[model samples]
Target: MLKDPPITVNVFDEARVNHEMTVELAFVNPVSEILRDCSLTPSGTGLLQWEELTKLPDLMPNNRVCVKLIIVPHKSGERTLLVGFDRASFKDIKTSCIVNVKP
Candidate 1:
């Protein structure tokens, strides 16, 4: 049985504050409603947003888990937003993204 690979998206500097590089993650899964009560934290920054999440109605399997995050490049290097799934959904799958904010 093959497992579905993790879904990743890039965050451009334009999305950041003052072109600082920001990313908005919209995580949706088949169990989104069930995990509605769940919360997410980016790099230990604490809960971001979830109340107004746009649920993705199309998700494989009746039981699934997804995550989204908006990251801002604080420095010149690459910063990865480690997505930690709560309630023991699955192992941690991290997605690394690069943000060049050199003006």
Candidate 2:
């Protein structure tokens, strides 16, 4: 069985309520084989809206891929944002990053 790749999520800058925030997700295929049928999206803490869908191609082995998501925060204060990953060959994955949103 192939092990799933580790997902890294980073919230960039500060965000205000009702404003847009950007979150970056990066991952590397540590296995010797390429990760196929990969999909990335934002999930959980439904306080934010997905502004765009990033079409992620199959990631090469041992290479890193970074994806940025533009999200509009609905509420303020500290919130746990989730980055979701769906793959055809493995189980789904979700990584969280706590972000402070101002009022």
Model 2: how large is the Cα RMSD against the reference? 2.6
Model 1 CA deviation exceeding 4 Å by range:
5-7, 14-19, 31-33, 44-72
lDDT of 1 by residue, 1-103 (tens): 1154243444544533233344554344433334434433345122122222333333434454444444444443333444433334544534434443443
Scored by lDDT, the top model is 2
**lDDT score, candidate 2, position 103:** 88
> In model 2, what lDDT does residue 68 have?
80
**Least well predicted 10-residue stretch by lDDT in candidate 1:** 44-53
Clash-forming residue pairs, model 2: none
Per-residue lDDT tens digits for candidate 2, residues 1-103, read: 4355488988786787877778788877766888877777766454465524455778888888998877777878788877666776656666777788888
CA shift of 55, model 2, Å = 3.1
Give the TM-scores of the predictions, in the order they appear.
Answer: 0.45, 0.80
